[model samples]
Target chain A: MKAIILFGHGARDARWREPFDRLAQLWQEQHPSTPVQLAFLELMQPSLEEAVTTLAAKGATDLTIVPVFFGQGGHLRNDFPVLLEECRGKFPNMTLSATPAVGEDLAVLQAIVDFGARAL
Target chain B: MKAIILFGHGARDARWREPFDRLAQLWQEQHPSTPVQLAFLELMQPSLEEAVTTLAAKGATDLTIVPVFFGQGGHLRNDFPVLLEECRGKFPNMTLSATPAVGEDLAVLQAIVDFGARAL
Candidate 1:
């Protein structure tokens, strides 16, 4: 089965969950059959390890990793690679290719500039 | 005086604020006596409007808005500009120059790529 994991920076204020959870829900709506999961680097439950394990448990050998982050910061650069290393060890049989972070994607920048124009 | 407003997406888990708060503290340490303010686009208090006014209230006519966001997501594209427009009406005397969102700027991309290389 194909499984997708969306990672986000964890937060203390509950409101921070709105977008993450909303995106999870929305992405699911768009891809109904894919097994989707949510993970955080810190300060939350269902971390990267847990999310990977859950998908593995469901017999998802094809995994698409998506970081729901705005930019490529420490988490994207350092933390995620380390997480992926552990993931490789745990799910040796699974095939994983990470989607570029939201920050690196061009469509995202377009959306941002398009929206920011209102300020002018 | 030059005042800077650092905007971040607030979160429920305190860990989310670490980078934001830490960056704010770091910038202040670098530029002592140059009034700096922290605000959130959402999920936190002392929001954009408040931050602008706070800087204005402190008699800061030259405002440098540095979005602490990782990318040019919704806040940079949508909310921030609207906030800035209102700021114009409120603080017309203030000279505002917004740096490109952290996402569009090349330095940020290098940081993300440098960090992600570890995963390989």
Candidate 2:
């Protein structure tokens, strides 16, 4: 089975995870077949490794990690790859892949533009 | 006149601002009448004050700042208000307002969900 992990740059404030929780909920609701988990880079629970372990134990053979950040900074370019490599080494049985930060998506950018337009 | 500023948490990598630049471009293209500018919270050029000043100079009497961040953590709840207050003090004549972070928008979140679904 396939699973998804919505990864984010976690913040100190607990409230910061609200949208992330909402994202996971939406994913589970819409894609019931594909299990979803939330993982954070730092300062939040369920690091990438933990999330991957959970999914792998749940019978997820293939997993896609989506970076929910708006920018592909050092975290994405540097830190994330190392983390993924570690996960890959630990879980050689699972097929793991990642997509670019959500901000790179045209539709996501368009949604932000639309949000700004509506606010104006 | 009215203008918009796309506010973001800047990163050390200059390339991280690509989406922000695209956002400003899309705004200019779609809303030709409303001038747009990009501002960073830190580690980037053109802080909020600079963007506001530029817009004010461009005959913008009303300005709307859209936080491109995904979460309203301490940065938004604590730091952002203080910065906004300073900007307000400097440009009292210009009406400055802000919308919630783009992440809070249902449409933006939906776009992210769709992006993840497509990647799976």
Q: TM-score of the candidate numbered 2?
A: 0.99
- Each prediction's interface RMSD? 9.8, 0.6
TM-score of chain B of 1: 0.85
Task: State the displacement of the C-alpha of residue B120, model 1, in Å, after optimal TM-score superposition.
Answer: 18
Please write out the lDDT profile of model 2 over residues A22-65, one tens digit for every residue. Answer: 89998999999999999999999899999999999899999999
Of the candidates shown, which would achieve the greatest TM-score relative to the real structure? Answer: 2
| DockQ category of candidate 1 | incorrect
True-structure lDDT of candidate 2: 0.95
The candidate scoring highest on lDDT is 2
Segments of candidate 2 deviating more than 4 angstroms: none
Which 10-residue window in model 1 chain B sums to the lowest lDDT? B111-120
DockQ of every candidate? 0.07, 0.88
Model 2 chain A weakest 10-residue run by lDDT: A19-28
Please give the lDDT score for candidate 1.
0.68
lDDT of 1 by residue, B1-120 (tens): 887876776755444555555555555665677777878877777887798888888889888776755445556677788988887887788887787655454444344433333333
